[model samples]
Target: MAFTTVPLTALGAAPWEPNTTYQTGDIVTYGTDTYQCVQGHTSLVGWEPPNVPALWSKQSSPADTQPPTAPADVIASNVTSSTVTLTWTASTDNVGVTGYDVYNGSAVAGSSATTSYTVTGLSASTAYTFTVKAKDAAGNVSAASAPVNVTTGAPVVDTEPPTAPNNLTAPTVTTSSVSLSWTASTDNIGVAGYDIYNGTTLAGSSNTTFYTVTGLTANTSYTFTVKAKDAAGNVSTASNALTVTTLPQNSTQYEIIGYFPSWAAYDSPSFTPSNIDSSKVTVINYAFLDICWNGRHGNPSQSPDNPNPNTWTCQNGDGTVNNAPNGSIVLGDSFTDGTADGGYNQLVKMRQLKNTNPNLKLFASVGGWTWSNQFSNTANDPVTRGNFATSAVNFLRQYQFDGIDIDWEYPNSIGVPCASGQTCQRTADKANYVLLLQTLRQALDTAGQQDGKHYYITIASSANSSFLADAGGTSNWLSNAAQYLDWINIMTYDYYGPWDAASGIVSPLYNDPANTNGNSQFNINSTVTNYLNKGLPANKLTIGEPFYGYGWKGCNAGPNNNGLYQSCSGEATGGSDGSTYDFAYMQNTGLLSADSTGKYTIAGQGYTRYWNSVTQTPFLYNPSTKIFITYDDEQSVHLKNEFIKTKGLRGAMFWELNADRNRTLQSIVSNDLPH
Candidate 1:
């Protein structure tokens, strides 16, 4: 019997074929079992037949055939300084080739049983070549694969941050505030954010290039530094520090808003009394007697309803007035004294006031609690409004007033008197009010050329939230007024009083818990915030602090209300029930005192109380008399002063000079004004 035939040529470089029959010594019958040779080895397995050739002729023709065509198409990718990976098509073998050998620059780099190899420890920035070959157990080496060369890149050095930003500039500058902004910085690794520093101290940080430094002292010197950061947390050295000195805040000029009786000139001995130091007094608001709708004939003492020029007097020194007497006048009448006719004496008095206090300013104020009704009508009509503007400038010229102040109780809104009429209420009042201001501004500018004066226009508005909301007027009105005027005065003091028909906290800096949302009703922060939110500039806002207190008859007088005024349960006290007194009257009465806790309290109407630390305001109540009064004092004013400093708002204002002629409140303003 003959065994399967053996082919020696087929076992050259291909995978070896093993014998499936016979394990250790299985029966080796002829034609039943076959024998085969392993790769690179001339050894036979199973039983060898007699016809089969034993010890086949050994072919010595380079057992490895050029490494199976040089392991076609070798490639190297994802190269690095530390390691280089190489891949290639598997080498072909006639018989069975166990593994492959990789070469680096013609040298054996590594050996693997698979088709891939990783060559490591090569210097960076250096070039390397890799090739693969087949290897057999007989120590046969096949032809080398096509060489693939790879050059590693140099090591990376991240030593710089993003380029410095551009267009760095100061947006706002105040005694204690400096706002700055700049273009963004860009970097290769991405920017993180920016850091702002005051001198060496880290003032603040922002993800943007804009930054604001707050809580600074006014008129002080400061240094600022800016730095840039990258995503990797790499920070650039701080930029050159910039040194700046805050500007001084000045309230040297004042524009009064109120009525000045036509007899103001003749009554200089009393009404025109000069109690205030001309040098110290900035502005004055005088109530009008007959310079508005009725013109010279509008005197209540004369016609009361019709124009009455017969008794209409002015400060002009003719036969009815004198220079010194008329000069006592500061602000003009709260009437639209027509430019063509009216208030020649008022104009004369204004010139006298300017001559007396060279720095003193006069304002031709228009509209009063009663006359404001015409504001809606005049403000809405372009012709009427234009006439009002012309009258305003003419009054300024005729009276030599420095500016104009509008006390139009409110446009399209009600105050003091809630009666509704065509002029009483109008939906277009708000927009019309703005239009009125614009028209006045144009007229004032037009008149400015001839008079050589810029008529500063201001408005006396209500201090109630209802007034603020109804007319869509806000503290921002001050900033808007800045376009035509100089300052916006917020009547912050009127937050209290018996006008509400309910006894409550007065001049509370914060909201009253009993009144929950009541805090929003009247507050310095609220009023100022309202204006700021409306885009009003802080420097243009002037906070109004009352120099007097409101007396009320109510119940509940204890620690909360302060044991001062009496608290009773009865019909509300007549608004006139409480004697109106200015800061002077309070100081003169020796009612100016601060508690151990730094709270202010007034013993008005046999009641004593101070400010609440929690509420930041003053209160008064009497147990026996059952009376209550709320007002402001030094302590409370101090808090407001600090707030103004914090918020970077303009200076403050007093209801009237007579309220603080003793310089009590004046000293406070003198101390707190920016400079």
Candidate 2:
């Protein structure tokens, strides 16, 4: 064919690149002929503009004059009250179809590059017709597709309110606080939350089924009811009423104390003093301030023999030179000059929080599970005790601590790493412990006079009844120690652990008849009763609870106690060594859950929950996996708080605060105990 010379601009052809992708309708020039892309493909080295016919075709003219064919089979699916999804067969164009316009009646609702489009924000319960139009890159448009009719579902009326929460019960009632719980409500839709009422007044609201009512008058009778609520603002009828009378206000309001472990800074969650909820606890005990035999008060130097090299020890004492007055408060990590050490620098953060909570007190707790090896050497003699007491006062003042908590694991019992040459668990530990407290009290009082403030002193005593008799032969150590101490934090947990051949509840509030292992006397009630009977004032005793639980693996599954108190071959994966799994770890990992039936379950972990009425505790067992887990949940914690109020005890204390899941267990302690 004969043709006149035409310029590249007249042909509407642009230069092509080897790396660029060209779709249909894109015209490119090679030599003199104008070529259009017949398919969407990337330009290759060999597949030049004139080399590939399937990808590129010679065009008579570069301008696209044809429009896309009309779409077909338009339909709508997945329709909702406010939205509808529309889909149609894709339209075809001589060139390339660029986009599609979706229309509601005659108005353009929206546009999309694909055949499927979703129309949103439509009025519910209304019928609507939708159509689509396809457009090419050259601005040519196709005819409208077939109309698709769709009527959105009725506006979810949500007229049916949730069923009322049932089994309203008061788990703990104190002079000024009460903890309540009920079975969750049912609804056509999911329930949102619950509202608690005192008589006819709304007391509080909780997302969960449980609520704690605070600021109530002491010794007053109050009736409570719970009502369920839905997202649509629908409220259910009131639950069964529960009437409870608060206990008489004691001379001194009970205290809720929690220990903040120094090593928690190294954990996965890295708990710091800033993580502490000051409102939930009256005192935060900084755990394990070590005592050196050389008259120094600080953390122990690293040792090769010990598994945890940073653990405190009492070796190599130099009595000639006194390191007492110059003892330093060692944190997890040290600062070089003026740098922050993250959570490890808890002392600085805790001091800052003190201004926010004036009622919250901070105490330095000396000696714990691993560090109690030196307690005997420090407290056995009058000279060492005097030196320790003097250094303790100096340490507390230097750290800006308001008080001291001596957590001597036991007086006459062997603890971890009782070195052969060290004097640990001596027969005279009980008498010496008393003497040490007396000395500390005198020193603290002297320091308090100088500082013009009363510095409190407390102790974490053993729950074992034989502890006193083992420490002192016929000596009333509990009575004698009470004179100098502000309160005694009874270690009521760790009654049973994986060390035993069988799995058992770690912290039962009451004795269990299923415990045939002669562990009936190791419960919280029995232990508290023993201390009270042995001349310990109820007002000066704070029952200790555990924030973690123990587990066992390869256990014998028996129907008698639902695998509880059954022999186990070995320890479980998470809680093998008494405190392997913290409450936060379990709850966050979905390893545990509490149902409305008052039973706790190991969710998806091949275990079933069983509740023991005698012990008022819950246990888990799995026959296939042969795993047994004994742990305390919100229900058990509430019951323990009730026990404390009933006994008129000082209050409650937890072993470590970081172990709790979202401050759930601590909330129970705070709301159930007297403020």
Candidate 3:
């Protein structure tokens, strides 16, 4: 009876349902296609008929054969040693442009659903010609776009070799390995490496002048020569050979963990993945991946802030809703973690160069001070915790990270309360924190087992002992969770800032006697001791230092200890935040300088820099403006490194690689740590 008024069936195929398995030749209609299943499989959002041709075949050719107009204004950007990112104006079609195909010469280099595409697997120092063509849903292709030529980068042909290494000496000799050191060699385009030879045979190589040659006979004498080499493979004459007898075996390398923030890539004169010198760091913690909930992310205390920003979505990398389980981790900023040319891709590029930096482990640092709001919710429940763990493993595998760093602000209690008296913290966070880590550890182990790669886990903790203890609510939860972590990044700075009414050290190596205020117990030494006393191993702790400083204003000079612990009338609200400034910013703003004696001072800004004997920190006090800044210099940074060794702690961790000036602090770290 209903057949009289029924409309004709289109393709006579029903839509595919999620998780529904279909046999080969089974038909389903979705979007513009009546697709026949070519492979028996269940359906998922990303596996739609149009997306996976191996599983489903389009049943008919497009009715509209008219192609889209050729794409215009082809442009290439973010070209690297092996990757070229392309962008072009959209093409018009009588129906519509379903996608675009990018061509390298005559071959199809890549395809994209949008106008932009990244042509990867290119060669270094090579030229590539790329053309883009538009396509309609009917598979009709448009004419090729105007070709864009892109050239990759690197040190060009170098006939000149690096200066020969000098003063070669055996620092430590073992039964199987000999640790050798020598004066660094000079190069025309920066020394790429040093080749160490046993007699006439190449035994091993090192990026640094120092390297440990292994696999020698025990108690045997070996003669070794060192030659400087450049990126162009040009090698210098061998140095005077040195002979040494082997002893018993031994080795150790303190982790030089540097926090490489995703936001750092957004800086002008940006630092990308290629900019990362693997030799400088043992571990790079890529920071602030967030937990998605309520479809919003927390802001880092900035205003006019996220408006018109990039990568603000809580979606997966493809700009699709994660649609995974609840409380899972998502890319913090997909724009910065772009599909082609952003930090995420850059990190992956770095990962692809594993052979170049065999020891450089990149860890994804999640839930920084601001974005940690959702962590409590994610960790509190088993379902969310399960989702968090699996999502984290997927992200690690997807992004090619070697580890994960949990930076939950005040895990269960006691820090960074939300605005207007809102509380993101929960009492349940204490026990849940350990469970969360346990889940992560198990998941990491399972994934690592499947891939035969060991993935690490770490926690970024407050350097304050009280915060560490108070967080657990008498349970000492952190100690319980330590068994699952590779190390703890103790944020040994931010003890005091402009936020404090009184001017104090930014991060003191020892407790400041003048710190009579609330955070009086804060200091690097006490924080490390607290962990040790709580039965946490010192070797599993990394002292987190700052590559930045904190400033306080309306301060008093003379007898006020040059603004140390001086009562500040106000704060230095002129920086990125009200209190923080990078070491570069201080010098750039002329707030820090050198005097006639080559001593660092703020005298140009009417301020005198002073060093605190008790805190082992530097401070700047302006008599006129009454501005006070407590910052770390090379001397202070070195002192902290010495502290790391003195306490037998794991290593040194900096708040950022971005804040270092001229790699000054970085060089200090390399020199200070056990090579």
Candidate 4:
């Protein structure tokens, strides 16, 4: 390949190393003036100051006076009452026009990368004059284009509301919810949506005629009515009321699992094993135990035998220091799980509850995101893998846990460490992971036979299917691994987060229509369906839900397009550290508000809540702050529980318990699924 390149030394760039990892605000000089780094990234030759404008911005420069020519032939189209879409001929610039700024009268309306811009939030029955100006990257502005006058249409005033929803009927009734559907209502403008009421109190709203009113008691009668409304805030009279009684809970086998992390005890309001509602779940995955490397628990600073000296003290609840060998399971935090008097005792007590309820079981989950660095090394060899399996059995038996859950964050990838420039283990992990699982399964079965109990083996699998599958073929990894496992908990959350380019739903139920950046497959529905299609039995797949949401702080479009699937300046700096906010935290801060058992959004604290009809999830956007947060609420969990039943899947599993408020999300799972 022919190439034309300039060396940094030749360009008088001393500090700008080709492979240097620079933080934000780090400055480097290329030829003359110093350029400041806008974002942290490893510098490549092609991604220099002049190439990536988003990463490196020119700090100070020898001022250039040349400006781009004015934009020509400015015209307005799609002129609505509240908006104007304008376009103009491209402006010529010697240094290249970076973007065009649109001006309405004397104020700046908006800016666009191309010659077109959409100026919104205009008052109806108004006249406006608009102009366009071209600009370059060097902070150069051009002369304005010829002005274009536009007259806004008269405001829409629809006084007449839609007719009352007819044929109100409950097609299905569960112990906790009622699925109601009615005929569409007619309106002059159009029927926008329907709102269901529980005897005058607003229960919920739905775009479609059908609404599922949840949080009802078993064998209780609840009268519901529906009303139609339009965009003009016109609401129709209530429909004829329909009364329905819910069915009583039935006996069926479904895994209603929840993760109980040991570190949640350090939160603002600490959540321990004692806080768990024993009746709400079939199993509690105790996260997490660590794998000891050379008689010590591994830390974030880990490599092949080059582990950090600052390691965690792995000890038993009885105050015994564990000098465990490689691959042996060790307590992540010994204090959190103390003697028979502390949280560890609570875990054992929860296990004994199975005497009264056979469904309840306790499992020890190992190797979470932070502790997964040693998983690859352990699985690389037979000696380590065997050590892991044997120690796993002892860990479960000693703690009186019923099972073991391996949460090797990723097999062929060095998950969290790689985020800070660390390398993952190997591609051979594709096969070795299955070998590791097979090893543990055998050990667990041997122990189960001796103990006269069946020990479950589950893995917290990633939603990234490419990690397991070959191009245009079956996932050899899952096929080989599924036989020895009880179930695969697909981590469907965190599909998009602060690390993502577009601020999308953390765990979308279905395909998102608004997601144009090509992660449409990163959704709950697609992930579950893909697993089933790949011959993994639905019963062995557990859908994962997120209690915490991913956020974008300063979105380019505030509430336009609902601040979703939009380009954002960076991570959100909401109450949570500019990255995530739990569902409980959201409720506490009023970023979310709804009826106890309803799917409809009531309001938010300076943030507007919007729903994605296709994804079947809710998101929040604060227009004033320009922060967007995507999270799953009780309604989404209710819908997902229904999806779980419809798909004949094992059940649902959320990230952790502390992220919920007043057992909001847990109650939904307990009421819907057979525990």
Write the residue-wise lDDT of candidate 4 on 1-675 in tens digits: 233333433344455667666654566786765676644556656555644443555553344568899999999998877888899999987745656789999898865655677888998989999999987644588999999999988888789988988988775555666667688999997788989999989986776665656557768889999999997889999988998988875536689888987756544465776677778888889888888764556453423222121344456765477767667888765555555123334445546656656768888889887678778767756667888999988878887888888898777665655312222366667677877877776677667758977778899998877655742222556756775677789998888887776778888888866688857678888888778777676767899988788788777663465788888877876654347787778777766677665643655777778888888988888777888888888788889999999997888898888777458888888899977
Give the residue spans of candidate 3 off by over 4 A.
1-251, 294-296, 299-313, 340-344, 352-355, 418-423, 470-474, 558-561, 576-578, 594-603
Ten-residue region with minimum lDDT total, candidate 3: 302-311
Between prediction 2 and prediction 4, the one with superior lDDT is 4
| Deviation of model 1 at 515, angstroms | 4.3
lDDT measured at residue 631 in model 3 versus the true structure, 0 to 100: 84
| lDDT (Cα, 0-100) at 509 in candidate 4 | 85
Q: How would you encode candidate 1's per-residue C-alpha lDDT over 353-389 as one tens digit per residue? A: 6566686666555545544544554554455566666
- Best-performing candidate as measured by lDDT: 4
Stretches of candidate 4 off by over 4 Å are 1-251, 302-310, 339-358, 418-424, 470-475, 558-561, 576-578, 596-600
Evaluated at residue 574, the lDDT of candidate 4 is 64
Model 1: worst 10 consecutive residues (lDDT sum): 51-60
Give all candidates' CA lDDT scores. Answer: 0.53, 0.71, 0.72, 0.73
Using TM-score as the yardstick, the better of models 2 and 3 is 3
Provide the RMSD of all predictions against the true structure, rounded to 1 decimal.
Answer: 41.7, 35.6, 25.0, 26.2
Better of 1 and 3 by TM-score: 3
> Candidate 3, after superposition: displacement of residue 346 in Å?
3.4
Q: After superposition, how far is residue 120 of candidate 4 from its true place, in Å?
A: 71
